[model samples]
Target: MDYLELAKTVGILTGISGGLALLMSIAQNTIGNYGEKEITINGEKKLIMDGGDTLLAGLIDNEVFLPSACGGKGTCGYCKCKVLSGGGQLLATETGLVTPEEAAEGIRLSCQLKVKEDIQIEIPQEYLDLKQWETVAYRIDDVTPTIKRVFLRLPEGEEINFKPGQYVQILAPEYQGNDEEVYRAYSIASSPSKKDEIELLIGYIPEGIATTYVHQHLKEGDTLNIIGPFGHFFYQDTDKPMIFVGSGTGIAPNLSILRYMQENDIQRPGIFLSAGRKIEDLPMKEEIDAIAADLPNIKMIWSVTGADPGTWDGPTEWVTDGLKKLVDDAKDSEAYLCGSPVTIEQIVDVLTEKGMTEDEIFYDKFQ
Candidate 1:
């Protein structure tokens, strides 16, 4: 063959070989049957999976799914398990969450820990109560221009029991543009004192699956499935003065906490500061005002980032800036905060700088 023909022939052969190599690699990784082995989980004897896969996948493959919010992404430190024995050395990806003591105790991020041999593991007790629920959307109301209040009542008799500040993961069902079920977390806006119904304050993000569905495509009586009540973000039983700060959907869990305090007649002295881009962004101002009015010890301050001249009268600055003027010192107060990671970091820095002890500051941040 001539030069051009010979080059074309070599390219075709290379492509075929590449395809075969890819197929063989996939087959070697997933197609063959992994041999049987006895694995002990939390002191319970069980026969399961054989070698060469991460322990998280092995457990899931054997019908035991861990509490992994990021699927197998390992970015979330949620998939932690205590490997009593047979687990190898600590993994690099898990070192951030697991301390040296914890590593010595055999605590490892299950997603990053591989199951080469039979192993034992322990999960948090609270996770045992976690479950996935399928429900129908009962209502949707615009809480603000950018925030939607979604109410989902369990099917005729199904019920959910969760704390007020807890959150749930909504499965973004496959739609025209996406084929995978994406899981997004949202706080429970309703009071925990009530059961059988759940409420969420969903903030819209353009092209975001769950947010888009809640804002546009979702209708009353649509089927939805979710799992959670995951994070521990609630009020502590203390009489310390409270300082609450939130913006955007971060307002979701804080609202629940305030409502819980109101419902229980908690008269602990406190101030709540909420931030928004404009007056229209203040979703539940009226309700919040009503609660404050009813509770003489509670106060509310609303900060608008981009206030209109001659239209808005609230503090015209960032939320943290306004909060700085409220208290000269936060040394004795307890703060409850929720928001994006950047927002949380800013607030935490300010609180610490203002003399608030590390123990007095608590936050629920979205990662």
Candidate 2:
């Protein structure tokens, strides 16, 4: 058998298939342009955008931002908006993400819904005022072996307004061998009062596009595009006591909320637990300790799952265990959680079982 010859033929076919896919995409975006169509937003503002693109892309191109972590990919499901009319049927990619209620109420993933015909959609009025920033990468650091700590500087004399625990979408440009430009959302780690510069913690995720670009290609002083302050997951200004649970880079927004509490002299009782595989995986420890020191009401707990007992002195248990022990104020406290979907869901179950209502809990799950 001519095995070598067969291998060569298979390789040739694979290359041709990839090339054809790229060509199809170009044709779809350009030659397939459906001309211009009017998008009536909330029946208040109307935008004229060329068809053949996702409604998400059209809205973004027109400076209206929606919370999308996976760009126009149908995976994130963060781009859900109601289409009052003219939005086609839901795509297969969205079936797993949208709930039955959402599907019944005209909710659709904007990234999967094409701008065919004139579409009338419902968008939150606040989204109309969202801002985009062209900033300089002020500084970058390898905070951990896998995590890069970045500080993006807003323009001189300009400040961004964001609530604690909110996140921003960073535009990851095509770099090195990467061929696509996509935006990935990350929670802001720095205090909102800092204003001029926002800090982000990005953990390298093997071949993940955004993490690869941030870890391998981005450099200090480079220009970065930012769109945000998106997501409903944020600090709620209530008199209730608070419990914050986070893991890995999920700690970003939790720390932001803690810093806000310290800076603003918010003295409500608070319990913060940040979990990681090892002690080093937990970033910004000293700053968190400082915040705790300033606010007597704040109690800090570090949960390490895989750290050596001789080297680490903190609790060596899952966040759920730590949560069970420390959530004494559950019924009177609001809980903030951030982590992977499984972790967030597990913690939510614990919180609810511990007497915290769903209304008293907020979370940001990294999909």
Best by lDDT: 2
Pick by TM-score: which candidate is best? 2
* Candidate 2 lDDT (Cα, 0 to 1): 0.87
lDDT tens digits by residue: candidate 2, 189-292: 98988888899999999899989988988889998999878878888989898888887788899889888888889898878888788888888778678888
TM-score of 1: 0.83
- Residue 30 lDDT in candidate 2: 74
Lowest summed lDDT over 10 consecutive residues: which window, candidate 1? Answer: 30-39
Q: For candidate 1, give the lDDT.
A: 0.79
lDDT of 1 by residue, 1-367 (tens): 9999999999999999999999999898776445555577768647478776778777655655566656556776777889888878897888888889988888899888767667877777676566777877888888788888888877677667777678888877877776766667788888887778888888888987777767777888898888776777777888998888877778788888888888998888888888887888987889878877877787888888887778888687776787778778888899999887788888888888988997888787875
Evaluate model 2: give its TM-score: 0.89
User: lDDT of each prediction vs. the true structure?
Assistant: 0.79, 0.87
- Candidate 2 clash pair list: none
Among all windows of 10 consecutive residues in model 2, the one with the lowest summed lDDT is: 324-333
List the candidate 1 regions with Cα displacement exceeding 4 Å.
Answer: 1-39, 45-71, 86-105, 112-117
The residue-level lDDT of candidate 1 at 113 comes to 78
